[model samples]
Target chain A: MTKKKIEKQLSLPFRNAFQMSLRSLKIRFGRSIIVTMSILLGIAFLMSVFSSNAFTNALIEKGPEALRATMQQNSQELRTRSIWLVSLSLLVCVVGIVNAMLMSVTERSREIGTMKCLGALDRFVMELFLLESLAHGLLGSIAGAIIGIFAITIVFLLQHGRLAISVFPAGALLKYSLVSIILGTTLAVIGALYPAYVSARMEPAEAMRREV
Target chain B: MPKEAIVRTIGLKKTYMLGKIPLPVLKGIDLEILKGEYISIMGPSGSGKTTLFNMIGGLDKPTEGKVYIDEVDVAQLDAYELAWLRCRKIGYIFQTFNLIPVMTALENIMLPMIFAGLSTDEAMEKARQLLVTVGLGERIHHKPFELSGGQQQRVAIARALANDPAIILADEPTGNLDLRTGKEIIQLLKQMNREKKVSVITATHDLKMLDVSDRVVWVRDGLIERVEDRANLDIKIGEVEGEEAG
Candidate 1:
């Protein structure tokens, strides 16, 4: 009898992983929304800080000297405080993401076992999780950027009246929004990494044996 | 004529770490299952029947010895190859009817085929046919939560048969179902075994399964206590209560 070499298994198309992740996100919409909210809040704070800094700069460069002098006096202290707040909020956001993802992995241990039994590779499992987090991050970040810009704009208009519109920092705000979006996406994926690895490394038998 | 062996285990052993100590689950099991055979492994809980099933299905590694499926040594395969063997060669059914809850019955069945790289249209067509075969033609659109226990098991059966695997490893496929449903599932499995000529191996406590199994292997204390041909032993449903009480 001759030994037969097992043919290499085909990797699942990215489209399948994308669709599967999308379907799961839709099914667990409430949980997805809660996770997304964490990203939203953190990115919102970051974006607001960015927009405010840009606004102050525009006011310093373009506003009346009297208003500019006061702005300059307070901008340094405000920037320092906002930086600390943004860093703290982002840390909280990452913790929230990691907690939610870990819970999700634990909750789906049986499903993961079933998928493995059905021949899903560890890579496929990881891909599904990462893609799901990516979607949440993208959605949350985009919404947060919009909300942040609107909020800062409202506050500035109230504080500085018509002068605020004249130096709204629209161009800088747009650039900052893009940066916030990318940061949010990267943070979400990084936060999900440990959870995804945990799920992927699970032995099928152990996972199935788990009561959860 | 002797049937070809589809699965063979030689000195298969598995030990689990119970904290500081190693507890042996399978104390060197040696067994052979023929192609197209319907075999039932019966044992009380903690008797190592599930461990044996997992070893045969390549879901767990053995601490010693080898398992050959269609003459391929399971332990010798790398992770990718093991996955391929699982994807295209072996199917699994669980006691709890572990269908992907988020997917409809059709999609649940289609998943394995998708993993096997089947085109979406082809997988869908075959999945529909398998659902019909499992007597779930009308429940294809329902999610597992929407279906009854028996219906969910039927979907799982269809899903297990998705890739035309050479063997179906079912760990107490009917464990969670009522007697009538259990009997129905046994009948369905036997029918599939006959029609598809796919080997069916089940670890079960359901006595109804013995009626259809060609051979019954009784396990005790992490070893095969006896292997009885169906014709050699008479089984009564009442014996289940007696066995449980013991």
Candidate 2:
């Protein structure tokens, strides 16, 4: 085959991604579902925290100085707790992603080795993992966005139908979406780095060997 | 550092030190594999045939030596270059037929092309042609688990052929199949070698597996015990490499 044919053959994209994801999914079937769920839970927690803050903001507005002082103190207490929970949840998810990626790459060491032996470049291999990470993160983010909004809406009713029509969540939605995207990309890259590195480094012979 | 050898090794040594005491996997080995040559490496368990393969294949670095594949000293390459060489040149087949389970047989075969950076359309077209060539034209959409062991091995062989590599290294392509299936797989591999003219290297404990190999190399205790041409294979019975029956 010509150089062009081989190059054309090796540069397949969506199929590669789909294959990798499927393999990754089976290799860590239980963990992937858990990861998706964990992401959902984290986003839900954020939504609850935001709506609670808004609720407290409304309650504090209705009172006199003495009640206002108490509400202010309570509000401060709520902020501290919410911030702590959010931070903890984020930490847990990060660790989870790291673990998921680690397990994924480790299990597929032979496969990665095979690819390299067949003449896959490091950047392309890196991109494979990076792409998988992106897909997972994006899928999670999309799911999280839809779930988060619903969560926000449901909790908003705790204020006794004060919000009659759906308010345009301009700044808040945009900010959260940006934040999630950033988090997703960061997590995806961080997750795939070590594994991709090991894969890119493997020699073809060792990669093809039978364990027994 | 020999000029004519596509793969050359110089005093290759790999040692695993456990708490200061050293356990050597490959003691000191030197050899060469020229282009388009079919070779089989045979040894019992723990004989280090696998380790030797690892070092030569560039899947792992040698502790104290140089390995040159396709004129580039693999031992001298940084990570990026090594990866590039692998993607563009080597095709590996594992004993387990490690096709990605979620993907169809066609997708599994398409993996190497994807790694080489082919656009999806072009990659798919090539993948289709390769799959059909391997006689799995109708099984393109079937996942790995959905296929039989022999079929999976065929898909793997097709995948190895996907990159049109300089060498095809199979650890034990038919290890998991029945004897009949094993023979069929060997025929497939031989057909690949003849048609594609790609070099082939296999590592197997199955004496039955060496019939089609152009050369059979026996490795014991991390050393090349012997290398025999096809005509001389009948005169030699390989020594046990590692595991012994009680």
Candidate 3:
């Protein structure tokens, strides 16, 4: 019934994972706060960057028929512009991933020590960090995706429906959102590992001596 | 005597490698402690009391010899087994009363139980009983930083007892307390020893403590120089400090 032996007796990795995460979150509330702030900042940046992307998309989609009247003069230039804008959105998301991961790691030093001392294995410690990063990434990217979709709609109305970009690729948008979220979390786990290891390998006496 | 020897250390040593050459801290030392005994290990700073305490508590291992707790060689245990041993059989209380500052007194008491996987209802019941035993039943909701030093120590005492460990190893438990609070903590330890039949081992430089201990062991330069009963505690020969040897 003691806390240390519960995992061995219960076979409850899922419950333990959550308990570890909550314990980590409790100990590193300040770090959690900072991680949340970074996530919000990254998502906000994604939204702003992609809002303009939606506008460009709308511009490219519209006026295609009009340009068809003079196809040789217009088609190639518009195609190049569309590729350039899509690349810009992709670049923003990559930057966002890197930014979020670094901030999350910097805030969670003592927490890793606490977990390791409590009998967490090497892989368990890694998974806790990974889980935290995944949670932030999932929440952030979903919010970003929904905002990007809404931003496209807003951009379409703002331009008075003149842009011809397909307004509704709901399935592609949903699938891409899920992919980016997973990718963002994977990047966060990588960024979090070095810090978590530095924190985990701390000598127990040293950690016990630490005031915090 | 064999069954009573809950902790035994033989020729234990530890050396810190400062830049290449090892700086020895604990020299070859041998000592045995019995179950349910109230003993105090006393010495001045740099006498390696903390190092020895950490070693016996399974938080660290000696480089040279062996340490056994309850017939199980701690030095032979792997990381997971060592942790389990520490969490289940040995309870440690520190000088700073290292209860998590964010947690309430009751929460700190229950953490070991929760970690050990007791059901919420059972853990709470045990925690409440311990807090009452430590005389902290009313302050259960107060966070560590919010409580006085004595109160915080009480919470730590409760935490140490939460899992019902056999040996309560305290390293300078009252180091940070004032005289009044410190003496009160000593009294609490004595009561726990008598009533709960829990073995208590404390390391302190406070000479006032040797008066109260059933066995007073003097440690100097990483080795035990003497083991004395309360009557023999009056002798001055080979004691840690000439000034404090009563």
Candidate 4:
């Protein structure tokens, strides 16, 4: 028999990984929703803070001189507190994402082993996980932004009547929403990195040996 | 006619670390499997049949020595090459029938072909044909959870043949089935071995496997205890029992 070199087969396209990730997210919808909710709450808090700060600045600029002095002091303190709260909330969000991803990896160890046995490369495994997290981040952030904008709009309508719409600071609010969405997506991918790497580097035999 | 050896293992050894201590699983095993042959490696739980199976399938690297599949050294291949070898040359069937839970039976079979670079349409067509071949033609759209144990195993068998692999490695293929179902699985495997001309190597505790295997390798204490041709084994126990009943 002639000795044949094992030629490299074509790597699977990115579309395959994307489709698989979508299917997985659908199949594990409950878990995906939980993960998304964590991101949603955190981003909602962030967007609310941003828009409120923008509205207050608009108010301070247009108020009487005496009212402006007092309002500036109050706004400074509020900004400091909100920053701390937002940072804390975002930190909790990252932790939540990391925990969820780790649990997902553990639960699917056998499935991972089966995929490896079926010729999935490490890159493919990583791609599946990263893509899944990206989807969660994108959806959660969009929903959170909308809720945050709506809540702030309602609060302004009650507080200042017609004046709230006149000084809504729409431009600043849009910019902040964009920032929050990008941050949420980036944090999600970062949180999933360790779990994806661990799954990608798993030993096929050892993974299969695990009962679950 | 001289038989061509498709899988060859030379002094393969594997050890697992139990915390601080070393526990040897496969001390040293040398074996050869011919092309288009059906062989069973039989042993108890701790006898290391699975370890040897892993070695031959390239699922794990041996602690020492070499495993050659189709005259190519498995240990020498890089990660990419190993993936290619696994995708194009070897098919694996697990006792648990580890089909992806999210995928339908048809999709599960198509996955391997997709990994091997087939277009979705081509993979689906071939997967559909394989499902029919395994007698699960009507269950192609069903998820694994919706299928019975035997039905799921049939899907797995079809998945194993997805890429037209040269070899099939089954680890306790029938360990989860009842006697009748197990016999059906064995018959399916034998038929695949004959029809596809793919080498079939199984690690099993199923004595029924001995009836169809070209050779039976009994493993004990992480070593090949003996190798026996199927013809030489005393398989007349069933007949003797019938005689006693008469």
lDDT per residue as tens, model 3, A32-85: 666655554555444544454444443445446564356446657856765675
lDDT (10s digit) by residue, model 4, range A7-109: 5775678888889899999998998898888888878877887777778887788755775798788987978887887788667656765666566666777
Cα lDDT, model 1, residue A12: 74
Among all candidates shown, the one with the greatest TM-score: 1
Model 3, residue B91: C-alpha shift (Å): 0.6
After superposition, which runs of candidate 2 have C-alpha atoms over 4 Å from their true positions?
A: A1-32, A62-70, A86-106, A145-149, A163-185, A192-212, B1-4, B117-125, B235-246
Error of 1 at B210 (Å): 1.4
Residue B177 alpha-carbon offset, candidate 1, angstroms: 0.8
Candidate 4 lDDT over residue span B66-104, tens digit each: 899989888778888887888889999989899999999
- Tell me which of candidates 2 and 3 scores higher on TM-score: 2
Runs with alpha carbons beyond 4 Å of true place in candidate 4: A1-3, A63-67, A210-212, B234-246
Considering only the true interface residues, what is the Cα RMSD of candidate 3 after superposition? 7.1
Give TM-scores for every candidate, taking all chains together and pairing residue i with residue i: 0.93, 0.79, 0.79, 0.93
Worst 10 residues of 2 chain A by lDDT: A1-10
* Candidate number with the higher lDDT (1 or 4): 1
lDDT of 4 at B209: 85
Better of 2 and 4 by lDDT: 4
Question: Candidate 1 on A139-197: residue-level lDDT in tens?
Answer: 98899889888899999999999999998888999999999899888878776766667
